[model samples]
Target: MRILQTDPDDARFAAWCGVWAASQRADRPDELPRPAREHVALGRRLVEPGGSMAGTHRAAVAGDAVVGALRLLLPVRDNTAVAYVDLAVHPDARRRGVGSALLEEAGRIAAAAGRTAMVAEVDEPVPDPPGRAFARHHGWTCDLQESRRDLALPVDEDRLSALETEARAAGEDYEVLTWRDRTPDALAEDRALLGRRMSTDAPSGDVPVEEEHWDVARIREDEAAHLARGRTVLTGGAVRDGRLVAYSELHVPLEEPERAHQGATLVLREHRGHRLGARVKVAVLRELAATLPQVRRISTYNAESNRPMVAVNEALGFRRSGGLSTWSRRI
Candidate 1:
């Protein structure tokens, strides 16, 4: 078996998608498979190599068939000391050393880039999954466990409306604002500030996370990337004293309209007691339901220890779907 560095061009990209889809189908058939076009768009981003995020892709091949693939992401700005790795091996090729070969290459590449630690995540419906075992055998520690939840759409309209009414009353002093696609110019600065706060406020469990600084330019870059992937972004925020204090976002994929992904939902420390978290989340869910009626489910992941956010999600009718274990190893 030979491992080769691969570009995300037409042929290699197709092979990469095949490997990833096959692996996920075998391991987690209940989850939605990532859209191929989204993979291509992300490949373009990874290949550019000059932004806050950059990555290298490697493929493990046996003769003419690509059996496994690995991606190593290095943050160009904050968290420069760490690298993220994702590995996928086709089900047909597992236990034949394909995954091991790919991981070895990833570690070599990450270490060469001056990264001190390498992090990876494995989704497990139960503890001691194959992926977890593999990581453990390689001397990786499970540092964090994240709870994954999903809310089936067409939520009881009457109940949701009633809850929204209560939340609105609780946050009577704050005004709620909603927007789609892009952040409004008037609220961009406040939104940027909130984005920075999200990095520090959210629970990270035992996983090391650096606070990411955000500005208008970075916000625009993120918006552009989402647009390129043909995804719709819906945002809801609470404003007090003409300043944005809390926000929630939902992403609907054009390629897979039946599913949506929940982004960050954060309320400033000074603004927490007013039920703004629940208010903003409910507002955005309503907005998404109205604007993207085809979305049947929305999925989100929260740190297992984040009880407050977990309560908010539970109150919004989300049910536990699965869990992920974040693993790390020193290189």
Candidate 2:
């Protein structure tokens, strides 16, 4: 077997995408099978090297067939010590050393880039998933465990209204504002601040990550990347004393509006307990229902130890769907 760097534009990338899509479907029963073309779209949109995050895609090939694929992400600005990886091995080709070969290559790439640790996540429907066991066999430790939750959409209008009313009672002093695509210039700085806070304030549970660096430029860069990937970013923020103190965001794929991925939802340390978290989330969902009623589900993951946020999600009718765990090892 030989391993090669595969550019998204390379014809060989379709082979990698096939492996990725098949592996995802086989391992993650909760997720529907997305066409390899969607995977291609994701690969082609890798952020440029030297940006906040740089990435590379690698494929493991035996003769004419690809058996495994890996995407390595190196954060350039912060969390510089770790390389985040997403790896997949075709079910038909597992246990034949393809995964081990790709893993070694990934480590070499991370080391060459001066990284000291590696992190990867998996969808674990059960506690002892094969993926977790494989990580353990390789001396990696599961550092963060999160509960994956899903809220079926077309939420009952009455229940949503009641949630909004209750949240408003606690957040009466704050202003909730939302925007699509681009954040307004007046709130860019505050949004960036909140983004940085999300890195630190969120329950990390020993995950070897540091506060991510964020600024207006980084925010704009991310937005541009989202647009490049054909995604619509919906953001809602809570403003207090003319500055954003809390926020929530969602990314909806323009081509597939049936589901949306929830991003960060944060309330500044000083701004906690006001239900601003719920208020902002509710606002975003309200806008989603009004504008994108085709969206049938919203999915989010939260550190299992974060009961407060978990409670907020439950209150909004999100139910546990599966599990998400991050495993890491010193490179």
Candidate 3:
């Protein structure tokens, strides 16, 4: 097998996406399958504005066909010693060394870039799925476990109203506000602060993610990238003393109108305990239901150990759909 670096627009990239889509279906059947265009858009974003990392794509070719693909993400500003690698092997090509060959090439690329460790995630409905088994066999240790949850849209109105009332009572000192697609100029700075807080306040378990630095420019760049991919962003926040103290965002992808994604819900440490998390989340869900009636499901992931966040989600009618296991190994 030979590994060749390829562009995302290459004709062979579609074959790589086929492998990825098949793998996702086998691993997490309940989730929406990403199309080839989404993968292409992701590739473009990885190398574009406000991206803190550089991405490399490699395809494993055996004889005349592509059987596997690997993407290596190397941080450009922080965690420079680490590389994130994702590998997908065609179902028909498994057990033929396709995955191993791709992983080996990924290792070489990471080492050449001075990376000391590599990380990847495996999705499983249970703890001992084939993907986890493969990662263990390859000497990668499970570093973190995230529970993926989905909320069916148009939630029971009475239950939702009760929860909203409870949250409002708890956050009597705070007021909720919302916007679509872009951050309002009045709240842009505070929104940036909350975005940065999201990285530092959330539970990371054993994952080695660094605190992300955010500002108004970075926020606008992120919004632009989402728009470029034909996705709409909805944001809701809790304000106290004219400053954003808690926030949540929902992303609706144009390619899949029936599905949405809960991006982040964060309440500043000092503002925690007032049910602001639940308030912001419920506010966004209500707005989404009213504005984007076609969205039937919204998915979000939380570290299993994040009990407070998990409780908030459960209170908002989210159910456990699957789990993600992150594995890491030293190069």
Q: For this target, which candidate reaches the highest lDDT against the unseen true structure? A: 2
Candidate number of the best TM-score? 1
Backbone clash numbers for all candidates listed:
0, 0, 0
The TM-score of predicted model 3 comes to: 0.94
Rank the candidate models, highest lDDT first. Answer: 2, 1, 3
Cα lDDT of model 1 by residue, 1-331, tens digit: 8888776674676787788889888877876777767767776777664567888788888888989978788888688888999899999999988888888888889899999899999977665678998999899988888988999998888878877888888879999989998898888999999999998888776666688878887888789888888898999999999898999999989978898999999999988888898888888988888888999999899986788899888888999987888999888
Model 1 worst lDDT window (10 residues): 43-52
Give the clashing pairs for model 1: none
Q: How many angstroms is residue 131 displaced in model 1 relative to the true structure, after the best TM-score fit?
A: 1.4
Candidate 3, run of 10 with poorest lDDT: 45-54
List runs of model 2 lying over 4 Å from the truth.
Answer: 34-50
Per-candidate Cα lDDT values, in order, are: 0.86, 0.88, 0.85
* TM-scores for the candidates: 0.96, 0.95, 0.94
Q: How many clashes would you count in candidate 3?
A: 0
Q: So what's the TM-score on candidate 2?
A: 0.95
**Collision count of model 2:** 0
